[model samples]
Target: MPGPKSNLIDLEILDGMPDGIALVRVDGSIIHMNAALRHMCGVPDEPGEPLKLESLAVPDNIAQWRRFFTHAAEDGGPMSFDATISRASDKFTFYAEVSFHRKSLHGEPVIVATIRNMSRHRKIEEALRLEESRLEALLRLNQMTGEPINRICDFALEEAVRLTGSRIGYLAFYDEEQEKLTMHAWSAQGVKECRISNRTIEYPIKNTGLWGEAVRQRRPVITNDYNAPSPYKKGLPPGHVRLERHMNVPIMDDGRIVVVAGVGNKPEPYDIRDVRELVLLMEGMWRLLQRKQSEDQLKMSLAEKEVLLKEIHHRVKNNLQIVSSLISLQSEVATPENMTAAFKESQDRIRSMAMIHERLYRARDLAKVDFGEYLRNLTSYLKSSYQPRTAEVQIDVQNIMLDIDRAIPCGLIVNELVSNAFKYAFPDGRRGTLEISMRKDENGILLVVADDGPGLPPGIDVSNTPTLGLQLVHALVGQLDGELALHREKGARFEIRFK
Candidate 1:
């Protein structure tokens, strides 16, 4: 029921719209069309000419358009559908979205439709979704640090095949040390002839094929038609599956090709996007492999160094034992009492040092020694050295570990103090007991060497004593950064504390 003015305004608005507009009679015959629609249909805007929907639609879509018009008339509501329109050139088709509405214009029943091309928009949306998937795959690859290389390659191949719609794919790693390429993992879906059963495959030394071309070029290569004749063409071997289309991506490390990933037999031609995605995943996996290799080399070097250090300790202990034997021979020839005592003391000191190396050779950690075990052995040796003596030696030391710098000084101090007690504390061969105890407390380590014998003489100060043994003890205590005290209560007692 629109007036003349209103109808004119509606026609003007329809002609100016970006989308194509057309009006058809209920019988499916075109009554009027805007300039956009006339351009889409590729016909002149004649006033009285016969134009039908069937003439504009592609032959395959003619039936679909008939069904759509029937449904729109029956439903009498706004309806939308997708269809292809034949272009005037007849060389290409246009994908479009068409919306239909039943309207009454100038007392005539007609179908109004607006058509918009959707091909470009569809491509844009698909690209966006593809980019999102690529980013997610990259993130998953980054989180796979410390995983085995085979597992990483398997994951990468699976994603590549899925994204590229490929029938089969594989990842191969190059060993620079060995100068060869080994296939680590492969993925095959719905491919019966090319199914891979082996865990790994070693390429021939003189590799000649599409894969070799990628390595030689040091870049990505895509072949839409593998069967085409060319100089780079190398046919598949016997029992090998056929390849229709293929893409190869090489991963580089320090200007050398370290890995190559390839996909084959896609339903369509492979494009740049496929190459980009595969390269991204392969590059990440290559970095992880490099890091793992470096770590393995470092561990091997450390093991070699440890073996060398243990051998050095063993030889040093043997050399010290030889020195101790020389001192014993010299003491046997000495007739003077003072000379014999001096030789004996020197022998004991050398043996004490030799014991430290012996313990180190036996220990799992070469840097520290079990001081308690060392003291036990030292006390036994001292008792044997003072043969025919009636004094009994007792040890009550805790199991503590000390480094070489502290253990050597501590061992010498114990030797000097205990030897003095056995020699002078009990005169006339009187029976007595020498006690040695060492413990660690919050303050520091405490060492006590005491004897149940005649105590030191009155007014005798150990700090100022002129005896070599006492002076040596004072000097060792100072080197340890410790405090020393002498207690004369029915026995001689010396205590020292240090960290």
Candidate 2:
């Protein structure tokens, strides 16, 4: 038991503490209270009578306080809890952290209670949680790349309404070419039950109301009281949802307002933080939309180029066919055997070049030709033109690819060498076999045209041969930057190697 002096010192210490301190009897009647406790309870400086602790508790919390006191006394242990307390005069409510303990005062048991206000700390925690949620929403928006613009806009609008605790949200895109704004996506929480039908809301942007003001100003617009009369006010359409608080942010691109985002009917007035969050979301969506548009344009450009290339190949092939036909006509009119043969050789060369373009027109990859298939087709044409009665042409070529630059010259070289073999090496229907082989190794391409018949005329110098065919072969070999060799042992063998 504390004596008079000890009790006075304890009262002084309790009064000096920051937390509200109160002493209550076992029945919950307040025996004594410090200045902090008196102020928290809204008690007058000079009370007419003692006040009960339960009186300071709001109606809903009175029973909870009674149960807490009973538990503290029976358990003989300190108890900590939280509750809302209200002042009786104005019914003002405040959250508090409270601790209770059974203690002996003047040989009688009493409950000592301490109260600490938690309103400020709770507000800070709530704000941090909200900021965290907004950051997560921003991250989700950034990850939606490559999606269609409409889908991205819808997601952004939905997230804006959800993050800002608004009932409805919409995103509109401006068509610069048409000089108009169109709503692309919208989300409404209660459209089914509301007076407004979502279908009726679709319309072009008009120069009226808050939305129009945002577009004209090209900045953010916020209104806490949308019902207030103003010069800019254009009354809402019939069956439209009533707007109490609203906000709109413009999405700018290339120094122009390309998109507008708006939200309305939030429980509380919109603040700068809400505007900032909505702007961030809209900006992210705009970037994604821009990227999707660029990808689509690139695809269209590539397709157009592909069509143009095919047309070019087709025209070139047709022109080369015309040149081949002219050569054929010239050969038919030539009287001299030598002049006719020269004209025929020129026709074969032109046809060989034309075949490359024909293959390119039909191929999926127009840049390179399937040289193996081209060689097979060329050999068939040469055999048909020369009419080799007894000699059979055999092809041993791998499936090799060459670009047009290399393929055209290579085709001419084959035409000249093979025609020479047919005319000179095997004469008077000489029965023999002609082998044509092409292969690619680490050393580069190797082409060999050989015949098993009488050898070349004795001492015929291939490097300085007078024959037009051999001279043409030499010139084409140099053009290909290739090494050429002539073998005249059994028949004629022409081999060329080029990188």
Model 2, span 333-377: residue lDDT tens: 566767866677777888888898899768767678999999999
- Give the residue spans of candidate 2 off by over 4 A: 1-8, 31-63, 85-95, 175-179, 197-206, 299-312, 315-499
- The numbered model that scores best in lDDT is 2
Q: Name every residue pair that clashes in candidate 1.
A: none
Once all C-alphas are superposed, what RMSD does model 2 give against the true structure? 18.2
Positional deviation of residue 467's Cα in model 1 after best superposition, in angstroms = 37
For all the candidates, what are their Cα RMSDs to the real structure? 18.4, 18.2
Our tally of clashes for model 1 stands at 0
lDDT of 1 by residue, 1-499 (tens): 1223236677778888888887777788776677787677566766355677656678988888888888776777978888888765443677888877888877776788777877788778778987788778777876776677777777778888887878888888777667678877768552357643543378753565766778777789998998887687666665566778889888888888788899988997899888887888778677766777787667776785587677776756755664566466445556676896777888788788889878976876667899999999998888788762878888999999997768877988899888888788778988989999999999999999999888878877878975666776787789799999988886999999999
lDDT of 2 at 11: 83
Output the number of the TM-score-best candidate.
2
TM-score of candidate 1 to 2 decimals:
0.53
**TM-score of candidate 2 versus the correct structure, residues matched by position:** 0.56
